[model samples]
Target: MSRTTPAPWRREPGLVGRTVEAFLSPLQDAYLRDTPSAVARLAQLRRGAGKAPEEVPELYGLTGTEGLYAQGPFADEKTEQRATVAVHTAVTLYALHQQSQRSRRMHRTGYELGAAVRMLMPSGEIDEPLRRRFVRVGTATSEAIRADRLRELVLLLRRQEVPLDYAFLADQLAQVQVPQLAPRVRQQWGRGFHAWRPPKATDSDGGGSKGTDTSRDAG
Candidate 1:
């Protein structure tokens, strides 16, 4: 009898998966990716209560990074791993759209063209929401991400780690022209997508880690 091999996720390593294109459009660059100067200019759009303004970069990068497939020929292991970033990024965009929609606030047109994405096993056998939609939409599942059997994918990404903040997002957007409102794409692959890890245990110690022994040595 053949023994089953361990699942990739079960082992210890950084999060890994494919970055499926959450949304695609003919006209690209609808939203502006925030820049240092641009962010300052948008003083009108203030950050939440005590948040730093820099956290919110150019809106263009944020919205434009959608539908970016990480490099080609995902047959190789390294290639697929690197491409996972796009998957993570897609999750960011998805969260942004969801939260925006959940709040019922009109930041963009009806949740900013909310796109969808989810983590999944490598085999792509997982019956995840995104997979379900993919079938209806007829998008290829070659790079489609499905739910992981282990931890939540979004949890791995740093809260402030916006994939769009980097130049890669712009480059990807530049390549493809996402026509305005072409059922245009997007996702929760943005900052603050998941609930932050609970407050860490306080290091406030009443005494030193090395304690002194007052008791005298036995005679």
Candidate 2:
């Protein structure tokens, strides 16, 4: 029998999968490392709580006592570890929120004529709800290639002292122009906005169009 080598996809894990594992590894290690102390602290807390010796069960069953231990010195060593995870999560969330704000700001600033037509007549999928939200937020425009507008928006956000990248804004504009290119570039954007597509206009007969224009305004 011949043995075949593993494929690249099978050999190497995905970036997102690796990132998730990396994020959880520390927590898992902390939990494993603290298990013994956690058990000891639970026993001590249970004894202090006046529970009968017979009433004490294994660590898994010592919920109330273990919970109390987790809030005390038993939690000290894990403090920095937990804080590191919390800060990472918070920063990630903030960055996402900031990107959303910048995208909305760019949409509000309007595009140049050519850019506006391309945006309105997108050849690829567009997220209707997001488009509607942009329109509602007074970001809808009729122009295209509004680099100056994007720069101004970035400047406004920078003035607020928010650390944002104008390159991100430029990339976002490029996304608006050719959304299909997004999936090839951003895995997260592709996954999150998978169902997003440009709104389709209907004929007077009330029947939907057959092509990509089949999408209608989410509003």
Candidate 3:
């Protein structure tokens, strides 16, 4: 949403990522503009979080995800399922993130899950408990468990007023569902966590100083 950043669609390279950006960007824009219809749509999507499509049939057409299946059938049903779930998870979490806030943008361009979580620490120091929570999220073996843990993390980010890149999150969610790709996804998360540093501070005289070092072990 920042004028300096590229649009979400342009930042995402995969189909699932593109789909998620397409689906949520407009709704986010409208909600920020105080459109009642978009706000109501976001609420409806939020309710579908961690829920099956059958359980929330009303959310079927609202995701703006027809592009996923429009091209043709996926190579396999599991791939298709993973893509759908990824889109749903990212969009729903975004809706939850956008809830109750109108001034700040919840769908930031480059804030991934790890960097966003890093912002939750006091003075940019990593807290052991938060680090453990993030570990559990990455180690989750089942989609159900992963979704539940992600739900908790999303809530934490919301409380701290941190924004995330839903496009990248969607891509990670989808890739993690694959056997070979899971490790890469986990590694990226770890890199993001350890590599995150607070923005440099500008001194009164316009000199810049680095932020506190946060690369210490969580243990």
Number of the predicted model whose TM-score against the real structure is largest: 3
| Superposed model 2: Cα runs more than 4 Å off | 1-145, 179-219
Expressed as tens digits, the lDDT of each residue in 1-219 for candidate 2 is: 001111111212222223323432332233335555533442343331212223333423322212223334434554333232222222122222233232122111111112222233234745464344333212423112132233333333323322221122223333333446434333422322233233354434333231122212110
Per-residue lDDT, model 2, residue 158, is: 29
Clashes of each: 37, 19, 0
Candidate 2's error at 48, in angstroms?
71
Tell me the tens digit of each residue's lDDT in model 3 across 3-31: 11122222434889888877777778889
Predicted candidate 1 versus true structure: per-residue lDDT over 86-205, tens digit per residue: 333333333332221211111111111111122222222344653444333222222222222101322222121211221223122221222341122222122111211211332133
Give all TM-scores, in the order shown. Answer: 0.19, 0.19, 0.84
Between candidates 2 and 3, the one scoring higher on TM-score is 3
Q: What is the lDDT of residue 175 in candidate 1?
A: 18
Query: Per-model C-alpha lDDT, please?
Result: 0.25, 0.28, 0.73
> Whole-model lDDT, candidate 2?
0.28
| CA shift of 37, model 3, Å | 1.0
